[model samples]
Target: MKFFPINKEEMNKLGWKECDFIFVTGDAYVDHPSFGHAVITRLLESLGFKVGVIPQPNWRTIDDFTKLGKPRVAFLVSSGNIDSMVNHYTVNKKRRNTDVYSPGGKAGLRPDRADIVYCNKIREAYKDVPIILGGIEASLRRFAHYDYWDDKVRNSILVDSNANLLVFGMGEKQIIEIANLIAFGKNILDLKDIRGTCYITKDIEGLKDYIEMPSFEEVKSDKLQYNLAFKIQYQEQDAIKGKTLVQKHGNLYIVQNPPAFPLSQEELDFVYSLPYIRTYHPIYKKDGGIPALKEVEFSITSHRGCYGGCSFCAIHFHQGRVIQNRSKKSIIDEAVKLTTLPNFKGYIHDVGGPTANFRNPSCKMQIEHGVCKNRQCMHPTPCPNLEVNHDEYLDILQEIRKLPRVKKVFIRSGIRYDYLIYDKNTKFFEELVKHHISGQLKVAPEHVNDEVLFCMGKPSKKVYERFEKKYHELNKKLNLKQYLVPYLMSSHPGSDLSAAVELAEYIRDLGYNPEQVQDFYPTPGSLSTTIYYTGVNPITGKKVYVPKDPEEKKMQRALLQYRDPKNYELVYKALVKSGRTDLIGYSKKCLIAPKKIRR
Candidate 1:
């Protein structure tokens, strides 16, 4: 038996190879951590199955499928993400809170492809390949969901991706079970017993009956119900298994597995323990661009998850609200490994995570008091979950810098200014400047408008200004060239022309013309997107402004990168039309005005 990975180029190059299984996908890029396809493919190879990876296949026609030949066992279908449509829509809809992807420029593409289109392409390509859909897109969209883009709920991707099976959440365990069952010669029909997967069928009435029986919605919405559901799903303790629902319709068999096991502390440890050979994009190989691997720097994960529940963000949904951390020793060892790499540079570290400055568990105290109710501490408001301590991080920083090969350490991740400002001592700040490799630190203030910032779960503009002032004062006293380069977002919900102009004014006052400005893309499963669709805060239930017009969105986005004269003219007209003349001559405000008038 052999395996085939079906993508256009690979299919053409290795046409019609006899294989036991085929893996099909639609991602041009590879080595993404979240996409377990790469690992699963490697694991199959290790098991002695002839496996092939089709990277970024054109799903436009059936010709693309015929090229891969046929497989003996099954065709594993994944689009890297759970559902391309969900990924595309959510990413496209998120407002540009930062200009990180600016170098790519405006490609003028839809944020995401709808699932129906992807499913149609799959149905056209491989009529009988036993398609299996898994990933965040498939997981969340497995059932009806609130679609922010369309402003209504939509059907599951299982109905759309045309796959034989849909696996949700982290696919490691489910994929492994799938491969093992196939290896044992159990047909897809006989393997519905496995947990942690969902499949589709024509028996819509049965499925509806099964779902309506107890209403997972009731269990899913309330915290206590959600936790009990999560425990039932993860723990899989037989005592909790209330009932099993099996629905069969026409050649399709839909099996919804009991939730798989949660990652125990040991399991979580194993995940981080995997040999993470971080590599740079081959495009950056020439200049030794991956600074950490080159020995010039080391990359460290400070913490994970963000408390700021931005509606368009997937981090909370995927990584969860609770922050998990590595022991200081684990981080220090990674730093030690950097020194051993060939042609090592003297830089000890560049530390960061989803949000740097967040160290340890955010709710240690809450756990101690046994009062922690929510998974996320920072949400709603910073909880008394854990002691907010920068010292643990500070100690790790100090330790890594002491290494002989380490000349300096840097914090490259965008610092949460609000968190840092709360630190009582300026020792961390002082050490940061004294040990700088680059004369700059990057931060994301996102937006200056109070309404926008509040919506983003960020500190007010005043807080960021205070941090900025302190940052500059420290740099001056230390006689360092290091400066704070802030990131800003544009065209988010609640940000009208006036709000955008206010942000532009703030940017100009900072004396920087950022080349990139991000327009918001609403990712699925974010609180922000929920608010975007409802025009009211999901948490607060207050009426809010959401810019619905395309022209208005474009003008708001232009406020960030108003270097081009055409953009300036358009923005100027927009601002004038909106009657925000008070922002016209402010240097920051001038981003949308003609250059000469500002001068």
Candidate 2:
């Protein structure tokens, strides 16, 4: 129930001369499973390994890196739960004012490019201590990819960080293998064949049956070459059918072994059942604790991996497109334990993962073969082999609702509405409207233009409309007044002013004002970001119009909130630019008035 040793004093209390592994991260140490560092450290500890953590180390100096001392095996470095660059700056490339992962919601607690910075500092202190990079930042940037902040392509993080290896995806499978081999008197350099890991090598003679991507120099200089490289990497992401991939950077080559296989049901359940303190370290209490833990503190991740292949999501790369779930008994046990916590408020914040309704693999073929290399399970239409059932999910929800102290078990995670609507039986939908919803159920429709959705790899707008109609009908039948809040986005690739007008008009007709809209952020490792950079779809090789101009992006964003008085001018400009000025007259259907009132 106590946290692992975090300082020399704590290590001394434990009577440890040296630790087996030291975990360095960019976030405040919260021993909750929601944090990546916590899961890896606790899992290693469960296996009888002495692991110490160095959270939020001062990268400017070597002092913090030396505190934990040298480890016997290796040092684990991660850029917290989010990529450091994405965490530090906004889509506009402006530095953000607040960081939720920091104590007291402060900013600038961790430096930019935290994984590279932390790794460099560790090398400065220990010289030869093995460094293993994991977490979202390293996983997404493991290959040569675009850097939105710098507006150019950058080398694979493995080259710049000088780490011995980079572990992509969920690292339970790879880390255990690495730790065991390294502990058994094996050198880190010889551990190159492990799946879900990448390493640098100068000799390519030993590599066989591997796909070689375009050299980093070619990809960085030519947009077409970049698209081809991205397309190849995108297709070969499956664990079952994937092959080792290699990309050259100068004389050295970055070789990525196939992704580690997804954990079985029993293994996945064990990961969640690990002894987690489920809160931030007590040392951070004086600063009012870490803001990131508050949302997940009361929540439970019922599963891992997502099948919904949205182009803008990093889950496809990090978690893979496979669905891994825990047994109902395991989830029920966690729900029972939640009631015993001192802060239990009769509400379990969530009972889902990447996508809530997905409780198993998308199809039987996926379990045996793997996800298709060329197509998504659910995109323009549901694959014929797709399994559309929510019975198991509904059963879990009903059981948790019957718990002794749990008054309401809400599902706060993103629920794929298209998948929900595809289920022929409406029993889950009916019950969801009746019991699970806490006044509002949010869904990500993203946008209403069919062409834009195609570019983003989302379902068409008609499918969303169908789901919305059914949701309202179910609510009416249940005698409840719950609402469906559709999440909207603006200025995604292929979304010109014309497409933005289509979405704005849909909002006008629906009479809903979005409180917030996510502009397309070109973070590394997403198909949408590739399109934004190359101006073409990587998969199809078709040219796409990207909204990169600052003024046009403003107008597109403002059109979503056109009802607000502050957005009048921008909306007017957007409508005029799109040649939709006829709709600007005095009419109920008009988005905005022809002219603003003179003050």
Q: Which candidate is the best by TM-score?
A: 2
For residues 1-599, write the lDDT of model 1, one tens digit per residue: 12233444544565545666666554422332334555455555556666655444445555655555666666665555434554343344554332111112222122244334444565676576566666566665555445656655454566555667777655656777887787787777556656667766544453332322212344334333323333332222111232344333234444465544433344444444544344433443453342223321256654554555555566554444445566776677777877886746777446766677776556545223322333335533455533556777888889988987888787776566767776778788777667743877878878999889878776677888898899889888988877677777877778888898777767667777787776776655555665565667645557778887888888887877666665877677777877876656756444443347353
lDDT by residue (tens digit), candidate 2, 1-599:
78888899999999999999999999999988899999999899988899999989878899999897999999999999999999999888899999999999999989999989999999999889999999999999999999999999999999999999999999999999999999999999998899999999999898988999999999999999999999888989989999999999999999999999999999988998998888898888999999999898888888999989899998999999999899999899888888998989999999999999999999999888988998789987899999999999999999999999989988998799999999999999998888888899999999999999998889998899899999999988888998889888899999999999999889989989899999999989999999999999989889999999999999999999998999998988889889999779899989877785689
The parts of candidate 1 lying over 4 Å away from their true place are 1-22, 28-35, 42-51, 60-74, 81-130, 145-154, 177-197, 201-265, 272-304, 326-351, 365-376, 398-409, 425-427, 561-565, 583-599
- Give each model's whole-structure lDDT: 0.58, 0.92
**Separate clash counts for every candidate:** 40, 0
- Report the lDDT of model 2 for residue 509: 90
**lDDT over C-alpha atoms for residue 297 of model 1:** 29
TM-score, prediction 1: 0.71
Q: In model 2, which runs have C-alpha deviations exceeding 4 angstroms?
A: 596-599
Model 2: weakest 10-residue lDDT segment is 589-598
